[model samples]
Target: MDVAINYLEENFAERKIKIQAQEYLHRFYGSLGFKQVSEPYLDDGILHIDMLREK
Candidate 1:
């Protein structure tokens, strides 16, 4: 993930990364510096929350 982000940073100047994380992995991603952007919602019946990380 870091490699891809580094490449994007060099190639495109991205400012943030966004994801829809499963309920169980919120803390894991949060620990990586992601922050919640939206309330939880179901995707194909599995709950998810939108998260974002500034690059």
Candidate 2:
């Protein structure tokens, strides 16, 4: 995870990295600088939330 993020931080020109992650993993992603950007929702019956890490 760190490796991928580091690569994006160095090479990607986008303003942020976005992901739709399992709702229960919010804290885990939060530790990596991601913040919840959307309310919880179900995707194919699994609870999920949208998050973003700004550049």
Whose lDDT is greatest here? 2
* lDDT digits (tens) for residues 1-55 of candidate 2: 7888888878876579999999999999999999999999999999999999996
Candidate 1 Cα misplacement greater than 4 A, ranges:
none
lDDT of 1 by residue, 1-55 (tens): 6786678778989889888899789998898888999999999999999999896
In candidate 1, position 39 carries an lDDT of 93
- Where does candidate 1 have its weakest 10-residue lDDT segment? 1-10
> What are the C-alpha RMSDs, in order, of all predicted structures?
1.4, 1.1
Error of 2 at 55 (Å): 2.6
